[model samples]
Target: MTKKNANTQALHALGQSLWVDNITRQMLDDGTLQRYIDELAITGLTSNPTIFEHAIGKSTAYDAQIAELSRAGKSGEALFFELAITDLRRAADLFKPIHAATEGVDGWASLEASPLLVDDAEGTIAAAAQLHRAAARDNIYIKIPGTAAGVKAIEASIFAGVPVNVTLLFSREQYLAAAEAYLRGIERRIAAGLDPKVESVASLFVSRWDVAVKDKLPKDRAKEKGNRLGIAIAQRCYRAYRELLAAPRWQKLAAAGAHPQRLLWASTGTKDPDAPDTLYVQALAAPDTVDTLPDKTLEAFADHGSVGAVMAPDGGDAEAVIAEHGALGIDDTALAAQLQQEGGDSFKKSWEALLKGIADKAERAGNAASKAGLA
Candidate 1:
């Protein structure tokens, strides 16, 4: 209802849930997060290793807690989860009203499973269950990658009643694979007479596709193809998402109380400096989908972005656009695999750095506590 953020409110009015892609304890403490919810129609949030690395490593807000946890003999992943879950629990509580009002359709917060378990299905599954249990909140989603192994874990985790946010998806095929896994899990739950309303969102990384192919474009065609791949891919995936929901398979599950796994647009922040700041946000607006925007993009959209026509359910021009890029030597399939692998690798690196940063901080905190005779 705030006049200043009318653009964002309009988008929400279109039935798309706008979720912030970053989370930090500082935002929670300072009421910035709450203001976004109140003014900008932000209904949900998500966090990953990189976001945590920056939040914990770059800010002193978490130092005292890290110190206390260190003093209690928690270190490494155990210490990190304590900090993460604490922040996410606060966020989840803030969104609890939205979650309840939507009957669990919106107002959720996501914390990713360990990137180190990207290829370890069993490890990912166990970690997801453990993290979900630890968070002890129904609205908190344990993010799992959509890797070959992760796909296996997704089905099992969903069957186990852990709401999953499937991350790092890049292509229509990959998205379908993750969706299939979700369907299988829900099917099993129905067969076993368990609750079939396990919620989920399959995240498709948009800007990363453009970032991956930007430099590879032919010089003459660069201008023409600069920032279109990601949108095209998203459009294609959105079509699949729409079709999937209308299928008899999903309809049956729906009758059995299963919720449709919403398609989420991730990595939506414009990576190209030349592209409009709110390019992805404006382009991907549609009903029944979630678009997770970075802080800058969210602010930019709130200020000046206009919602265009919603995406075509039939994927208008997406295939032709994809073919154009393909003819220029960009292979969508291979690139999707490469992007996913690179994304997993990048997150793994961040995970290592995050753990190391925590260890270093904990050591400093411990030494300081000892010097003060409190250890």
Candidate 2:
């Protein structure tokens, strides 16, 4: 499709990168991802335990690799990473042209560290380092959740020159915390005479906030009150992100070759069936940010989406929207905390299930090999 015919191309023209949040070996081997890059201007992708779980559990695409790895005595997390890293490396290679063309601003793929390390700061850092090294691709980002302890790991990881995608951020405050951690890492790198051009993105999750508050909102203005909270929060975070980019501190780092940490909008798929499929994707159109869409959402946008008025850096109506919710007894702080914790827990569960899926696949493969006298 030509750029004019594709709304995703229009989004790219507006300067926001379109990243597909879901990935599978089927997609990569079948050229689905390359087509996205060619036609829709998809410059990057992000991954988490849930996406990996679904990709592995639902497909035989990985069975042979799993069996081979199992035969080599790799199991559990080790086997999972081998599978993940192999897929991501291929994806990273496909995006490498864009990575070089953009000088590292776009064309990136991410692999999250084990969700089991959420509370383990030191372990998180070590795992991030190991994963980045093991992946051995500069275009890949090692994802770390933006939890309190994760913030510490983010700083250390960035200082060590590991490109990071800071994930699971919920609100403006959480986004700022991730930004702070990223900035400190950049600043330390500058001081230590290291390259301050480390790449990072603070991923503020949208859509989930709306899902969380929809049932709790007043019925009278529920249309106005529901589903819009996430956009408002995202706009507010965007305002903060713009402010940080303009700060003297950031400017100083910029002078020393540091790149601003771009704000990424995650969870852009609309959870409410009543809402438009492209709600978050269209609403979050802005320059210097990212909107990571699910495959269905990406296709919907490509088919029928239009760019809306870009978010006001001054946070147009975001404060009022949030304050109105606050007046309705929606505690933003409490809810953000709960969301972050729940997000971590959810990922941990997915990680466990992913391991179980791999184990099952390996066992079945072993059984089939023995039956065929091939073991």
Best by TM-score: 1
lDDT tens readout by residue for model 1, 251-305: 9999998889999999999988888999999999999999999999999999889
What is the per-residue lDDT of model 2 for residues 75-161, given as tens digits with 9 covering 90 to 100?
999999999999999999999999999999899999999999998899999999999999999999999999988999999999999
All models: lDDT? 0.95, 0.92
Candidate 2, position 189, lDDT: 90
Each candidate structure's count of clashing pairs: 0, 0
Stretches of candidate 2 above 4 Å error?
1-5
Give the total clashing residue pairs for model 1.
0
Candidate 1: which stretches are off by over 4 Å?
A: 1-4
User: What is the C-alpha local distance difference test score of candidate 2?
Assistant: 0.92
